[model samples]
Target: MASGDEPSGELASSLRAIGARYQELSQFPTVTHAALGAGHATSAGGQTFPLYTECSQPDLARRRRLRFSRHYSVHRSPGSAVSVSRAALSAEIHHQLLGQLSPTGQHRAVLTRCPGLGHELLEVWGSTGRSCSVDLTALGKHGEVYKEGPFACLTWSHAEKQLLYVAEKSQPRPQPLFSWDAPGAARPAEEEEEEKGEQFLYHEDWGEALSTCSMPVLCVLDIEESSVTVLEGVPEDVSPGQALWSPDDSGVVFVGWWHAPFRLGLSACSNRRSGIFYLDLSNGRCELLSAEHRAACSPRLSPDGRRLLYLEGAVGGPHRQCLQLRMITWHTRLTATVLDVVQEPTDAFAGIYTDALPPQCWAADSRRALLSTPQRSRTDLLLVDTEAATVMNLTAGLPEGCWVLLTTQWDLLVATCSAPHQPPSLVVGVLPPAGQELTLHWVRAEDAPPVPGVSWKTLTVQVPCGEQSPPPCGTRAFEAVLLSPPAGAALHPLVVCPHGGPHSVFDARWRPTTAALCQLGFAVLMVNYRGSLGFGQAGIDSLLSRVGEQDVTDTQLAAERALESEPLDRRRVALLGGSHGAFIALHLLARHPEHYQACAVRSPVTNLATLLGTSDIPDWRYAALGLPYSFERVPRAEDLAAMLLRSPIAQAPRVRAPVLLCVGARDRRVCPTQALEFYRVLRARGVPVRLLWYPEGNHALSGVETEADVFGNCARWIIRHLGQPCRAAPGQHSP
Candidate 1:
């Protein structure tokens, strides 16, 4: 045996440092936290339960989940309406969660797990309304959830004893920084003065891309044994997402994603294809359902096993208002049902739902269904009459700021409700039977944090119509909400905010940042531009191929219209946005240079042409740049040329507004290189620009401390650029 007589303390120190880094990476599990319980009216002895999860942060860096169960008895109304407020509700966020009641209502099952993050554990519970406590520690590798897959979720079996979920087996390992085997001839360099420094091309596309070696598989965890079984027959090439067992638990239906020879970066794009696949448990064979030439996801099987409901759309497509949620007959005994919506709406399916929409209990006839939708910039419950082929708004009388999170057993609705001056509160409302009117029973959570005093009102901004003539294309109108601080001696600075997705909307939901800004004496105009959802198809269609141009005009006109009514300082106006919202902010400042003073953007898309090659949503450039996106191929040179012309980078030289860029170093959807390039260009030109780097941040740049830094800097930056920071109490406006 050979031995080193002398100890090398230096080598030991280096080895320990590497081990510490590995441990830190391992601890970053994709864990979701939660708290609270929701309930609804239920039948005698046979009741339904709504489980709530809360993330209790003992430290800014670590999080844990706590579960709550509140039962609503069908025989009686629990209490007089329990009124909940908004400011108190917005602080709760949980990871992918599933909650339901057992057949006898004697027990309930709640499952919660975090996605994309590593080392986090899934929290499971079996409660009986009175007592249910199971220690979830010291579980072996069979129960661990890691970070390599495209998606993961936790659900309960029909019997409520076994847990079924989508799991990815391959553990992600650290890859080498660069490939070392390549050898190429060097080109002769021109004099630095003669050459324009060869524009620094970018190649940061893969940071957010899925690892090639990883794939998703369906797995079942036995609650009693704590052992796992990877389902057989799942293809190596197909990665599955969000799945559910058939009503009888005889089959598993899930979303299947097949990769092409070439991969797109993380920015969600319409060109990627997905379909619904079903695995017959008896035979262990997987078969493709409909969804060809369409991206399908979030499949739900009716309890009676008579029908299936799922969403079909170009998820990242420009048709902001066109995603559809359709229902198909599921009688295998008869012929396979054709693709069709049991009830199709005149307007495109809208609101925030793919997987977020909770499956409601089937009507007594087992035909009609209940669900929530985003309509007219507000979240509402819609009861779908499958046979009648019509949709009804159950909560039509609810206030404007009402946003539904998800529904629970026996028609219990969980939502966030608020009015201009009211802070958001956790709302628990009961839905009356079909023919009767709907009323809400709410609960006011104690020890809730206070929201800043702010008042809001709805307003519409009108922009010019058609092209050449007086009646070529009609004028379009957009709706927005004006949020303001208490009246002061002088008018406050106006900050125009835009929503991302380019296709998304700025709805009545309570935004903590918006309230914070109002507290600092600012008037905020949140624009629901032409491309926003909730409007009719005509409104969303107007922005199809007119992204940079039409969206820019809409934002500018909305800002001008808002200033007309609000008492805001015209000279002290500022612009803010993230993602595509940031794209609009930058272009507005460049095209109409004097329209705003300073601009602040987080993860803004600077160059569309560059993004075509480096962004996770590679096809996004083609679609947003006015060309149809091809599912399997990257855009050609001509398509890229058009993108370059439409990007904000083309007008960067015209921007005179001082700019601040916030970036996440670990973002996969939109890389940080875009910001680096923008920062470099501005610095080189001697323009006023600042860049803030979040070393371990992702696309949102979020964390307890990181978010505070990002939003705090945002408000402070605007105040500094606008004029002065005022700190007088409400009604004590600065003189």
Candidate 2:
């Protein structure tokens, strides 16, 4: 029977029965598109044509082509026949002309004139594998002068029909490329004389003026004349990372507190409130914009250039709320109004609520916006109409996971959907004229490997809470997806996978881990506990202070319901999670140790106290746990205490499962020390625990190479401690 059609209890039984079948099917060899063939147009000489092919050709050809009309036309004289002899024209036509005229001919042509500025290299590739490069320097006065990577911030200036490039200095010194402008230029005699007089007046002045420190510098470049001017000494309080120019390009808006008149420390005012300042280019004058207690970011200019739009708050601090978008008018005064506000819903999903993820972007007209609302297991994208105060869910049925939406002309929407089992892909849709039906275009089916002999089925389970009736509380049924391995004679191991985000929801998608586990003969059950985002605010609000309790019960119930339908070895089950999911894993071991034999946690928040105190973004903890930054002023310590009661550190002594903890050393979100401290407590209690630390990683380990390592390590550890010898070695396959 298909698991999707079965009740939650029956679904689990079906999965156990097929475990062996899944394992057997997983051993077969898999095939993927490896290469494409070269062009096939015949040359004039009748020789087998060879146009251009980078790699080896595939055994079979599968071509998808698109063509459009060219806009070139010719005019002929009136009353005169313009027909020319085809033979004569063909003989005279050279290969170059033929290549240029041939619609199917492959030839590379220069696309952009600029070259060697703005990172010195810009490569663009089309879907058809055609690539073009542009050197910004070659564009003369039009080229960009400077570029910064990792974030791709760039700066350039034009003067006298010439473009000048300003690039950040590389490594050790790490200074902004102000030298790109006025390179090798000397100061005027009057300035030199004034500097000398100042030097004589004060020794400190001489040292300060002569010293050159590496910092973010703004340069003015003239591409036509090939000149550079280095504007070195910026205000001391200006943070380079937050420095940007005004919309009219007349001044720079610098955020931070200045220490000396010119030496700015990036980390100095990071924790404190920052002010905005405007620097005039004409007279080299600096003026304070506002003394507001907020860090400003993402400054955008209104279409009419009358106002400025920017997000204000410390980059990662407790005081950080998605500060309202304020429109600063240029009347030399700042009056602010909140463009977006959080709406409190009466029917919040199960009474669950969190400030919805701030709207990502505003529509071109500034009237509509996109917001992400994440429940415990899923996330939903909402289209907010500011005019009507109405919100429409754009991605209604997408499974629980992170998604991003991009708007095009006429409000056409494109989004990328992702989940544990599903690779991210672009989904395009057109909103109807009346905004009724959304026509989705399936450009391409996702290319994902099947789960060998196993198949996934969704089941509806009545999640029971002690306070509720036996049939379960609130919503009568919660949907859960179960993956059963191939047919097996004996009971197989079970793995309960709880998604990250106590407020996130789960969705259906292809997952490599799910495939691997099924191949290894384990039945996997994924649960969408309360507080997950998809079902709306109420669903997410339900799991607020109930994380360890409600979420754990949901996961346990899903697993037990699965077992009821299938014969399984209950003692062989395990739990696995990463991030918030990791918190769930630890919670399982602490509160229900007897249910699972082992657990794996990746970048888990072990101690709620440390999470609140040490996390780079203090606002996240404050919002999630409803805690105040200052202990002396905390109003709801009792509620905060109740939430912290589920901290894994507090329950370390009671956990009996062998544990594996993974952390990224440089993780700013969830401090690496949290995992270290938890490991310390667990190890001291004589509970089996192991820790893996990546020195140069962040909160997410999604880069391909790193992900491979993470998955491989997880698989190896699970197999090793679970007393399971590999039925087949890694990379071994059947014909």
Candidate 3:
């Protein structure tokens, strides 16, 4: 039977038994979206402020999508123990709900239900009891609506009469050669030929999870007129996204990316040639607001609309980098100029390590904004004062956890904080005064129950240094999160998980899979190898052109360190990775075959040579190799040789460990061919291997059923290969 398909033999019963462990952990609530009102209300009982928040958790038992959304009203009082009042706003099954609170505190919510399916509903509701429902499926004129990525947006106009969002530009309808019209119908020859030819034309997409998104255009929906118009002023070469209505509501300001170099994947990538542009609806003219060469995005206007804030980074090289905060003084609509650099990264601060700022990030003073950014292993909230050109870390005094700023309303700041040992908890606090940190009196808006019998600690791996050998990747050390099982066995099986995006960091936060694995009696190790984010830019820059060698070494050293210090069974160690992490896992399995007993890779990159030509971001391979990349650059013999030399396939013959490959057929990032190449090699060589193909899944394998199924099979593979029982009794060791 195919992977993810039901099996008929005894293996089917084993998977079902192993998958039951994820039920409770998968249902852990997560704060999805929250909105704060403009002002508070005073009642006879006490002063109460209303805050709207949405909580979602995966319904893994269901055969449909994994998560369901629940809306709540959180009420708080000043100078007293804050209590949250749970009032269910609605019980609708909405895939996404974007809530916008008007300046007058009138709530406006736009719900998109059954997204990505042929039938979709766009429902809008106002606090005054007025609502509108638009059948996006029946319209059939526009493409799928964007709900994620850099282009995703849903914002209300200043006057609250219209809604603005981003969606794929409509394509020309192609009809069959023999139409079902009247048998004797006469049609123009030119029109018939055009329709027939267009049916076969190929169009490129944004790739990976956003495969359906291409040709993003600004769309405006006028509620009063019940009309939707696609704005046409944007240049065809520029893909506009993250649109916002101008201060006066006369035009739309958005980020425009040039299509010349080919639209590289924009998922976790930040360094793309893009600029902030303003499109005037009256004259159908779009003007670039930021410099043409700067990679800029996330434009936020102040409350008074006097200044704009954004983040900018270098144009090329590593897809993700430390961003510099910038500001623009909007003296008037006629003219706006680059004001000054708000904050440049220093050795102490590590720059702005986030893609975008939260909505309503501005403080009550309007001179500062609250930003959540990663620093090493923890995510911290930063207070950026534009006037003083200073950045302060606000979470320095808070409890140990990853603190993320969700949204801000006036002087109130809302965030979700969590640690490896703790579940995510939504907390709201009043912004503390300058120079003073926030007191620990934050009111808990909502909290998720922690998983039982799971414990964790952060580990620092010191890179081995010899007199003759310098530190690999220009760093002497990195960190890892080790989740230990309950203290039953002296040594438990270990599963080393390295995250994707060599640039991405695995923060010390509660993750569903990590927690579930621990509950299943495996000590999980998440390594933040060199070049991972949160570390200084120097760390990120050190990994350039050294993809295979240094990254592989760093992961091995980290795992070795965890094994040495923790109660982990070095003999029963297994490997788990995705994307770039998978590349490293494969390299480790081949180079140091004895260190790992089994391996599981999801959407792995086995050969860079094959992926460079088929991936959405071909520049990734070149950049990883420290070579120049452009749309016009053709792969030469030497370049191909270098890619092959660094690939895991070059050393696949040395791999003796049983491997499990989880591939997404729709993945455009690493390409399914890369995984298939390794599978074919292992199979031909008589090596033990298995492949699970998710036909409808993307690079993330994010489908509700796909994720649960993949995790269950992965756990089963590791357990069986490591000589452990399929279902170990709680607080007991499996012989």
Candidate 4:
């Protein structure tokens, strides 16, 4: 405790050892030979310092008895034998201690970070006269007032002084006391800051979690002043999103919520019911603008501000799932009319559907709205005329093997065309006046990768409509995109790769993974099974409660159709899928074990009962299990039992195919445990199974490295197991 003593660490450890021995010897007063206790030295000065304060009896009682170390030779009557060594800090020093302590290459930061595009904040990416330029003034500097993550409800005041956007609730909130780099006064550690407990939600449905009815706090960032202010008037229980300023700039309108009372697990719910609400920024009074009878989303005011355009769909489903476009007279009074409702999936471009929901845009004239609609197999750019009650397919001629993602200028269309044969390329186009068959004239704004040396075709399979035998789902036709190997002399092995989402679509866009499989000499059948988009809402609704039965039959019918139609090798058919598609693959194998030679699935949903408790989307179980879920609370035990009855595991006993389960350790949607549990059961039942767990992956396993591993390993697994007769796990083989 001397003023010049800076406290030696080696001396400290040696002193603690001696004191521990003294405490142990004190337990037995009868045996006392040496005066055992600690002595501290002033480092390498060779001078020992006496203990400054009386050691607490409690401290001595709790300290463990000292033992001889393997590293040191403990001699009787030893003076300090502890060695002083400098601590290793750098990563290189740690590497010298072990073999796998270094990275393969240096970590690089983004030198040219893509300054994302937005309308309310800045008008940058395009121009009228010369070459397009970007305004990077606001890049990388928004953190002064705003935190990270996607910004919702982006808008600017008519005067352009203030900007508004909704941000997520930042957790653990950086602290100075826990930080060693900075100095600060003292404060108690937050429970949230504890190691390895709660992590920030980074799931796909995080938007619902972070900005729900009870949360979605609108933030006003002052551009000139560099300050943030939380906007009031948004009701605490009514979560607001997709906000925009009114014509007079006196009010804010947004998609508003008043759904379930609780907030837990809202992120992955079907989240359908909502209505438009307006907040008068003047007096901070909020009022509902649209009726709550049906769900609606993407509320947008026209450029002339005369009318509003929005999407309406079934309640307790996606607000735009039905894909009906509606318009409301805004200025005079609020009167709503359906501009487009999906009555049929025929000639009319009545309902909209896309790979994911595309952004709705207003034409410069403000009468017609431009958007994308998913027709049976391909997604087409469509123009909806609200006043005329007619919809026109603007980019219908984009072709079957190609898909165009549209972005619009005030008048021209800026798009990126992605085809199975080539990489995506940016192009500019026009709608061509007066409809002499409006062709999307491409102006080649950016280059594309050379066209692939392969052939592609589309197949329309007549699938049964009913989940039940009498055909509750009827015999309806669905499409599949077939990618053929480069040189097809002999018949190729058929790979049935069904698209997932149960509500999603596989567009005719360039997918390297699928192309890679085809390049490896497999004829990949990318089946758009029942319950997929592009087909109307009826087709999707058909497979809802009948997840296992309908989708399974559809795949079988599709594969049969493929054999009848394409030059596919009958004995070499395999199944490949992920998520819901994986669910289909596993269930198909369980129900009809001999249906495929082998199967590969990634992050599969094997058991609804198992997933109901752990998954982010519990409603998915009830919905898929033919039970009604209100999204308010956990499903009952009886409900779960019924769910388990329909689970793929129920029929897992019939599985005869060699199965490979691809699991993502960090998957939050379909937790990795789901795949592990499935794998264990299959192995126990003597089914041939293998697991490929990706530690750095999520529900998608979508990183470049993970994706590459998936494609390579997947191809290898299918190829290796393709012709091997049903081989159960060892020790259980039949004679």
Best by lDDT: 3
Residue 72 alpha-carbon offset, candidate 3, angstroms: 4.5
Error of 1 at 148 (Å): 12
Ranking by lDDT: 3, 1, 4, 2
Which stretch of 10 consecutive residues in model 1 shows the poorest summed lDDT? 22-31
- State the lDDT of candidate 4 residue by residue for 54-135, as single tens digits: 0111123333322111111111112322222112221111101001000111111011223354212322111142121222
What's the lDDT for residue 330 in model 1? 70
TM-scores, all models, native as reference: 0.77, 0.55, 0.91, 0.71
Collision count of model 1: 24
Ranking by TM-score: 3, 1, 4, 2
Relative to the true structure, candidate 4 reaches a TM of 0.71
Best candidate, TM-score:
3
| Candidate 1 structure quality by residue, lDDT tens digits, 1-735 | 111123246434433433332222222111122222334444543333433433223122442232223222222245333333322332444553444444434444544453553333444444523233222222322334423333555656777666666645533232334424457745334324433333443322223534332456677766666666778876555667677777777878887766554445422332246677888989989887756666666676666778876666654455333445566677662223222321222443333332334544354345666665556456666666666655666656556465454444444445545544444444455555655534444454322233444778778776665532221143266778788877877877899987787877777765656765665567888888876766654565567678888787778878888777778788888999998889899899889888798889999988888877666666667767657776666568887788878888888888888888998887776778988887787777777788889897777776656765677566555655675534322321110
- What are the runs in model 2 whose C-alpha is more than 4 Å off? 1-386, 398-403, 406-415, 418-422, 427-437, 440-442, 445-492, 499-511, 518-570, 607-627, 631-646, 665-687, 695-705, 720-735
**Distance from true location, Cα of 465 in model 3, Å:** 3.0
lDDT of 2 by residue, 1-735 (tens): 000122244434434433333333323222111111122223432212211211111111122111111111111123211111111111111111001111122322212222333234333333375344444344332323223211113332111121222333222212332334487786444333323323223111101111122333444433334344544445654433335456556666554343233221122112234555676777787776654555554444433345554444333332213233444666565746434322222232211122322212454455555545443234556654444545665565555355544322223343456554344443434333335534433231122233334556665677544444232234434656677665555676777887775555555654556656765666778877655544533444455445566677777778888888765568688887887788878877888878878787788987775665565444445545544343234435674475468677778888888888777776656788888888888787778788888776566654444554565556555554554522321222221
RMSD of 4: 24.0
Sliding window of 10 residues with minimal summed lDDT for model 4: 94-103
Q: Which scores greater on TM-score, model 1 or model 4?
A: 1
